[model samples]
Target: MEFIDLLLLFVTLFLAIIWFKYWSVTGGGQKNLPPGPPGWPIVGNLIQVVLQRRNFMYVVRDLRTKYGPIFTMQMGQRTLIIVTSSDLIHEALVQKGPIFASRPADSPTRLLFSVGKCAINSAEYGPLWRTLRRNFVTELINPARIRQCSWIREWAMDIHLKRLEKGALETGSVEVMSNCRLTICSVLICVCFGARISEARIKEIEAVLKDVMLMTAPKLPDFLPIFTPLFRKQLKEAKELRRKQMQCLVPLVRSRRVFVQGGRCEESNIGGDMEMVSPIGAAYIDSLFGLEPAGRGRLGEEELVTLCSEVINAGTDTSATTVEWALLHLVLDQNIQQKLYEEIVNSVGKKGSITEENVESMKYLGAVVKETFRRHPPSHFVLSHAATKETELGGYTIPAHANVEFYTAWLTEDPSLWKDPGEFWPERFLEGDGVGVDVTGAKGVKMMPFGVGRRICPAMTLGTLHVYLLLAKMVQAFKWVPIKDSPPDPTETFAFTVVMKTPLRAVILPR
Candidate 1:
């Protein structure tokens, strides 16, 4: 058996080499294709990328120097087209939105994780995606819906402040991102499920989410599904991890469903006799039980569990990371921090209660948040999108079914677009060229931290508002001080999202 296994591996590599050589000599039928490095045949650029390990973003950015703004690379059998030019991104993702809207065909790993593309995050573009996204927007992230959830944020903020205070008292410093994730998870659970849960339960859910995030990180087998059998351990672990996720999620969904059906939730008293507070239209889980996409029937319990997980996972990490990045930049750049602090004081008055309304008037605060997003987007790459059909992009042909991506962090720092693009200057958005910059890129491609076009994040409004309110309150209540011996570092670690490689440790001095 061992010898047979080795023989199979040898045969696979031999075929890959022969195919690569043949394709190379033929130039892979290179008529109007975008130029790219002649990656090794068979495995293509996978080896080079894998060698870099975690710094995939840096590797791709370096490639732009040789291949220009638009380029192509082969990952196993997959053709990945990366666009760095905002103009080309706008043209493909916005102008030709429909043709490029669909997600790529799921790899075996993604199929297992998304449970056959049932979750909104991985669902193919069509009625199913539209229905899921619409339900999410109308019930959760919509302006009015977000306003309704203001109390939840306020309540969570109180808990967060208390934790910070206690931590500062017990130990001279606190890890902001860890506490930030806790606060975010708490708020998301309450708003998403309409029930407040205990710290123990939240940790359980976080542990499950952590597993999912780790398992879903880009793997070699995912790009080349032909080798999925070799990833049996990973695939099995994914199945078990998802099962664990469902164990945590299904009960919440089922309990909510029972409550909606005039049956009291069994776990209502598990935490604090907290009857599910979200009325029919106020909660995402409640809304899912009624949705009937164009041709598909209403969602099932499994789908509900996955979609709800999507909301919790997407909302918590992205929002928390943005705030984490913002605080780090503020600590490192004191001048920018003081300017924002003064703006907040002048607008809200010293010690005045800061509210969402106040956040709107604090233009400098908004600029700071925007700059943080530009400098360190929550995710360096937008969710991978696939071309639905062969199309012309940047005067070159993008083959159908090709995976497409945009390096948002790099685009924001494009030298041609911003003056002193490398500098972390909030003033660029204040009175300079970035003034009134529309992030959606409808008017132009300035910055796209939330992405743009048809597949733009439905939660953009809610996420941005969360960042503003959290940053304002944190800045208003306390002055953050770096640990005496260790200064904050801006190094990034990519999990599900890009977070500080080292959690920001700082002392919170009450203002």
Candidate 2:
């Protein structure tokens, strides 16, 4: 029976390949598409990509060099338009924002986790996307809300410092990335659910979300639906993962709903003294509960779970990975570490704790954060973008079906844009051409660590603040030194985000 199933699958694949090859030949091809290496019928450069999957970004970098900044690659049934230059990225994502705003279709596994394209990141560019994105920004991560959440940051930092101190005492060194992940996840969980959860609970939720991220990463079936049946085992695993995810998050959503209802009743009973009866908690979920998209009612429990998961997953790994990269640089360069420590000292002046205001005043610290973002962006590519309609960009026809992605790491490292793109020099931001650069890409995209234009990550401000505060607290709390016989290596790997291939291990001495 197993042999029969395998034989049937091979026969189906062979026939599908023939049909795809014929369709490719007979289909109307768009003229003036960006030049790219010729690919085999049906597969179309996928073999090469798979052959070099481990260092995919490096492969893209070589292609950018060979084919110039704007080029194309056909990956299975998908047409990938790769843009590596800042000017071109700005042109497409900002100057022509609307045309390039919508996202490509989600994979089958992603659809299960995203609850059928209901999450903001996975939603199509339209009323639903706008409603969800606006609610997240205004309600949870706006400037005023961030100020209100300063206490949460402080609380997380205290726990983080204690853990690091304890680890150093017992083990003689601390693993930086895991601790950073824990701290960021704790802060985001509070912000998302408006509950001060136990540490064990936080770790549980974090582990589940981490599994979801790894499970939903791009796969062969994602690019080629015809191949999905061959991946039944993986698909079954994804469904189980989603069930586990709901098990972890749906209860929090229900609890928050009850809290909101109870508060409303109390406010009515007490002559509408809402402030006395209820305070702001679960800002993200609260906003979701109130949100009514066009034609659709308030989000259902599954949708709420998906959005809340998006919030936590989006903010946690990116910020934590960036903090790890920054700490690794500081550990490798003692002079840089000493300079940053001096800045923290001078700004706070032996204060017991580093305040948000203190972080604001430390210019050098800000420079280091910016430099870290440029050198080691959390992800090498932004979320895949799609054209709303057939459009022309940089004298090439962009078919509506093509998946447009910007190679952000290449843009930051382009020699023409910076003096020493290879060096981890924060001083570049203090002077030189890097001064006064805009990260939002509003003025021009010198380096887009967070991305740019209409579809930029909504939590950009919150994410940056996390990195800035955590890096400040970590540096001020200890003197970081490289572990003996295990010097820090900045080799890169693709995880949920771009992280150090070998996690940073450093000795932390209390200051």
Candidate 3:
């Protein structure tokens, strides 16, 4: 029996090699494809990636040096076209927006969480995507809605500052990232469900959502569906995680549904002191309840859960991560921190709590946030984009359905684009070439932290507001100093977002 099993394993390997060779010859035969390093059979560049033992971002950075601005890689059955420079990115994503507006087809695990691509980010460029994205933008994050939601930010900020003070007094040092995550998650939850949930419940939702994000990340079976049979355990685990996620979020959806339908929430005790249901500040779920996608009926229970999950997950981690990075830079550069604090104090008298209006007025604070985004983007790469159909980009035939990667981080760091691109100097935005730089990539693609063009993140405004409010208030409430015997390190690793290799630890003193 052992001999038979060995023979079977060998036969399977032989068959896979043959299949890989056949695909390599025929699948990548398209002429005028971008240049990349030679790949090994069966594994493509998977072995090279493994050998590097670095974050994929760094690996791609090195490859960019060798392959020029545009390149291609064969990862298993997938073809990835990586675009690194500003001009090519603008040419593809902005100049030819419609051609590159759609997302790649969802991995099976991603589809499970996205409810068959019904959510905003995963959905293709079509009526469904438009309906969902338009609803989010118009209903939840429009300028009027953002103004109305100031109370939520204020509430979350109060709790966040108190928590930071408590941690600082008790431990003499505090972990900034976790506190930031909790605060951002709390604000997002209120916006999503139209209620201020208890800290315990908020943490429960955050935990499950975090698990879902990790489990649904691209896996081996996602790239090589032929190997799906070997990943039974992983797929099963993903399903269980999705179940856990549904368990945490679906009840919130049902509660909101009741409120939207009956004009009163069944669970009055859902929030702390405030009522969970409010007609004045309608939540994202409220909008979802009313939405009818073209040809499709109102969103189903599973779709509602998925959309709400996307809202929280998308807004929470990226915003929190940016706050952490910004704080770390401030800690490293006391002069910059002091200048920003002075600006905040001058804008809103020292005794005054930092308000959104005050935040808008503080030029230095805006520059600091912009510089942080440029230095350490929330994610090194945007969500993968795919061509709607076969098209030409940068003089190469971008075959249909190939995964196109825009290395957004590389664009910000390109020396040609900025003076001293490596430095974390916010003043660069205040004067000289960096002045009036366009982040939207409309005028030109200098830098795009939140991405650009049609499919850019819908929550960009809200996300930036969260960062501005949190960073301003935190700095106003306390003085953050690096921990004794330890210094700030900006070395990054990719999690849900690109984050510090060592989480920021600091001592906080009440101002």
Could you say which candidate leads in lDDT?
A: 3
lDDT of 3: 0.85
After best superposition, candidate 3 residue 91: deviation in angstroms?
0.3
lDDT string for model 1 (86-144, tens) is 88988988899999888887767667767678877788888888888877877787678
Residue-level lDDT of model 2, residues 248-287, one tens digit each, is 8877777667768676433222222112122445367878
Candidate 3: tens digits of C-alpha lDDT, residues 369-472: 99989988888899999998889998988877789999999977888888888899999889856789988889899889889999898899889989999999
List candidate 1 stretches off by more than 4 Å.
1-10, 13-27, 263-275
Ranking by TM-score: 3, 1, 2
Ranking by lDDT: 3, 2, 1
What's model 2's TM-score?
A: 0.93
Model 3 scores worst on lDDT over the 10 consecutive residues at: 265-274
Per-prediction TM-score? 0.93, 0.93, 0.95
Give the per-residue Cα lDDT of candidate 1 at 29. Answer: 46
Model 3 quality (TM-score): 0.95
